[model samples]
Target chain A: MALRNAVAQAAVSVRYVVQRFSLALLVAAAIGVMLIGKADTVLLERARAAALDLAAPLLEALSRPVATINRLIADVEDLANLRAENARLREENARLVTWQSVARRMEVENAELRGLLNFKEGPQATFITARVVGDSGSAFVRSMLLNVGRSGGVTSGQAVVTGEGLIGRITEVGESWARVLLLSDLSFRLPVLVERSREPAILTGDNSQLPRLAMTQSLAGIQVGDRIVTSGHGGSFPVGIPVGVVSSVGEGGVRVKPLGDVLRVEFVRVVDYGITGLVTGPAPPPEVYGPPAPPPRAAATKAR
Target chain B: MGDFLQQLDRWLYAALPGTLVAFLILLTLAPVRLPEVLAVAPLLPLMAVYHFCLFRAEALPAWLLFGLGILFDLLQGGPGTPVGVSALQFLLVRQAILGNQKYLVEVSFTFIWFGYAVLSAVAVALSWCAVSLLMWRFIDPQPAVFQYVVSLFLYPIFGWLIGRGRGRDPLNAPDPRVPGSRP
Candidate 1:
């Protein structure tokens, strides 16, 4: 009986030691993975895409009920404020009607000027509509997964927009799913220009409601309520796409309130302007070195 | 017949933990939006790890915790950000909880809640630090704060669900699998 007890205790000890050792190894491996991921290996990208492809269908099915519930809630809220909304819409519609004539006149004048200047037309953009099936839901990253992918011609770097305004751009695409890096993500940056001044600047996201403007040559003429639009410097996005309006210029710096309501985005249009080729082309091959020199001329010609 | 019955019992026991892990994965993937409340949803998997650590540590082994964290990191962090942050965070939380298992047993629900609060705060802080170091910039802390508050409020609901699955009050019963523990 004492021998059996000793054997049991030994087994338990071994098991405990094994568990602790394995845990330590796992922690080390996790850190190693984080380090390697910073290099952005092709294997990691493919694995992420594959995982997203597998999870997309399940996420779509799971999100349907959520979408339905959200729609129901929105409908109920609309009904509750129907009369006030109707009055507001009527006033806005009347104002829009007056502006319509002015916009028509400007459009005609703009076309005439373009023709006189012999301005070249840009590539016509096509769009693919997609539903948002999931979000990262982490505080560190601002991204959402859409139920569309390469199969739908949604490629990386395509501009994503709602009917309201610019939402973000596609950063990763799987077989049947894509991830949109939102304008509110900390790493997001884009070239933007103020409409009134046409002064160019960088719009940078800091995981906040309002993204800040940076790298402007001068903030002298920039002011609150100025419209911000894509300057299209990198050729990844088309020019003149409305992004947001300057919301505030405080101690925190100038902030732009995005026109698209990212929190309520159910569907978005992935716009392909046919300019991705300029940004992502095949890399040039490394220059091949000639064959190595003959080893040291056999070491003894002079002595011989 | 005896061997078959024993095998079936083993499978059933494994299924309980497997299902919980699968559920946690699905919750992470689900896009349940509550715009008025938060921009980012609460961390459901963190709550699951916390609950199992207190009530069913054997169900959640260290390796499994590590695997779940790795999966989360892969899905959560894109190419722009460093991965494995969540995995390391989860592993540390699991280790800390398991190491304190002795003192944790027989503790009141309030004390357990407080413990979870501290664990979650640590997890959030770790993630923030990891991300800031990786990006070389300090990220906004508002979303992390919101996630912490939301997860804390949502914990009791998950705890109740876990308790129901055990078919007993987790607070009242000591886990039988834990050696030298009493019910």
Candidate 2:
């Protein structure tokens, strides 16, 4: 009788524990869902800090192995020697010399035109160089984190570029790190103009692993391989920053092959277009209704 | 007075270092490329979630995991990157694991493996769909759609490894938060 009573009591206790525990867990989970839905920058910062702290040791531990392997690979490449590379470069250099002569002539002409035209000098852009600390490991997100942060004069919305061209912009700035939103990201939108036709279009990404050109009017003249550069209309990105070349153009949309390899980003420069003077000139008085003007000719046509 | 101070000191130590070490290993190994099927490896976050959920639920609170998801979002700055969605998926999976803990506890490796395969597939699919909807693309889910299949395929092997690894290690003593062990 005693043994049976003990067994019955234990079963009841186990059931009670499981039931109570699960109820508590369910309630906690609901609250967790609500909190996650409202995720914000503050939350992101904390998580990043924690991750950095956690990852520091691992990074330190793996750093040596990675360095050694890289060094060995470099030595092997060196042994394979610069002979083949030199041959390729010589061929490329011969072709570039002809292009360089033309480019020089064009520069001289451009200088003369600038002398004749009374164009105001735009402010020079300043840049702060940073090393990439961590990479986005998610396939869905194309972003990178840099070691430079608020302390390093990094600010949100600053353009991040490389020697090649525009990469992305800094979206989040922590004390010691900043996150760059790559141009390839689905959320990224840039005002770009075709280099050849000077046709303005919005570069939008659909998260299809490639960004597409949207709102492109007069696509009849546009062709694949045309270079796209930033249009400084909205003053977001500086004008004429090389974005990419048109890879594929279709009735649906045009795809751009971005200049930056985003995957292998090691170093990045954050443009420090520091404090600008406020628009001192008063806003033009509200425009009175006026007759619409004639359509303007293509800018590229006039330039040519 | 000496004994009291010693006891107080003992209360201050914890298992946080070990947990952080594990997380660091996971982060370093997390793949960061596109074409999810090609560049990224298996779910590092899922591994963390499983470790914490089963072994130390108190350490990885829901809020903490939610924040981790956003960190991923900020790191991934592209549009439609769903930090909130992924967090929700982790939360749901954890809950399911907890809900079925009674049966799961008694099950063999095969059952656990199959369970993870199905659960991980659902999670990855939900995440991909969320990303697609955010981007306003109804395009073919090819390539990336296969990630779920991969996750399912890898589930059994990963589950066995996790189970075996955990079993091999000593259980975290009840008072893991306590400092020096008592005599």
Candidate 3:
């Protein structure tokens, strides 16, 4: 009786397998037809986005230990190499002091110059700090996961920057995690203006460490080491924020040396901008200089 | 009722090995970076299918293979891409091997690996072309070329290792028709 029962159970299982197999085949065929009729990049993108959503929290947890170990190793190395580092630090400090003095004098001079030349602050921006927790190291795309997410007020398209300069923008936001598509990603494009020449160009990444500067009107006035800043042409980033410096120049193109260290990023700031409510409002005008001069309208009427 | 339970146990047992094989293949494929040779390893799923077809054909049917493909597609994070297409290709190859089991079993391991390499390459190329077409532009071909060559180069070594390890498992037990093998 036991043997007979076992055989019956086996037959039931086989039946289940057959049923499921047929269903899967049908689904596969349906998918194939859809794929052939017209490829769906959006659907595949959604699937990938879903997978990333699931993996983000797990990746954040995984990155904790690596960060801890890296910190510990760096501490140990610092201790072991204390004497040399001390000398290096001393030299750096001295240079910083000199720079500080120069900076102060330059700041006073700049303020005076602004008063004379009427230069003005561009826009108002708010910021929130976040930490980098995960990196997707695929060659086809460049993105890193941040611990801050929707809960922290990070939303898709919000700009991320660092002490050095512009990093990337938030592309995907989960409840407590977000993905930043770094400026070096193949899909990322930013409007930029050269600091020296003010010539506009589109910075495009090709999944490489160095993103290329495209759409340049003329490379004649540009030089290596020239500063690049957000143009604010798209209203995405506040203008004049440092993006990167030109590292290479060619007949038709240039490459940027990104300010942020894409390889070893640990923390980033998510600029809140908080301007969702005022999206259509004109940006507040710059403060009047030269001992609080008359309002622009009054001055214009007086001149007339 | 008892018979149903027994069948459930058998199917569950059969599925475990394939799942483990899939997991290991994924683990190896996960951290592959360049500047080191063998950066992106070969089409690991093809190897998995090949193994099951050779040793435990009943465990991994075409449907399971297809599901595995779709799962990988989802995980690879490139949407609109159908991983099932390549998986279906693996199923076809397995079926071909099964149809000529008697003749296929007689071939040497080297020939078997060579056949797998060709089959896997074709499948990979097809899936890649499908994705490229879907995305609406031709992406650079360097990455695909790198993945194909590396996978093909390593398949033989991996095949040999799997063959040697298949010795102790009852499911991987040599066919009763092979001379000197116990039933």
- DockQ: which candidate is best? 1
> Clashing residue pairs, candidate 3?
A9-B3, A9-B4, A44-B79, A44-B80, A45-B79, B42-B151
lDDT of 2 by residue, A1-304 (tens): 9999999999999989876675456445544543453455456456555655545344445544544554565557656977988898899999999999999999999888888996675667888998665555555665666767888888777788998888887876766767787787656778899999999999876545568888889778678899999886655456788988898888668988888666544578987765321211233355657886445576456667
* TM-scores, all models, native as reference: 0.85, 0.68, 0.64
Give candidate 1's TM-score.
0.85
Q: Candidate 1 lDDT, tens digit per residue, A155-253? A: 888899999889898989887889999998887889999999999999998888889999888777889999999998888798988999999887778
Residue A212 displacement in candidate 2 (angstroms): 0.4
In model 2, how well does chain A match by TM-score?
0.71
Global lDDT scores for all candidate models: 0.82, 0.64, 0.68
Models, CA RMSD each: 8.0, 10.8, 10.1
Give the Å error, residue A282, model 2.
16
Candidates 1 and 2 compared: the better one by TM-score is: 1
Ranking by lDDT: 1, 3, 2
Looking at model 1, how many pairs of residues clash? 0
Best by lDDT: 1
Which is superior by lDDT, 1 or 3? 1
Model 1 bad stretches (over 4 Å): A1-17, A108-118, A281-304, B1-13, B79-81, B168-183
Candidate 2, after superposition: displacement of residue B32 in Å?
Answer: 6.1
Model 2 lDDT tens row, B120-159 = 7777777777766655566345434555566556656655
Q: B1-183 in candidate 3: lDDT tens per residue?
A: 866866675566666657865664344323222223443435666667776787677777766766666555544432223445555665666666777688666688777877777776776676656656665666555555676777777777877776764554443544877776642
Candidate 2 residue A141 Cα shift, in angstroms, is 2.3
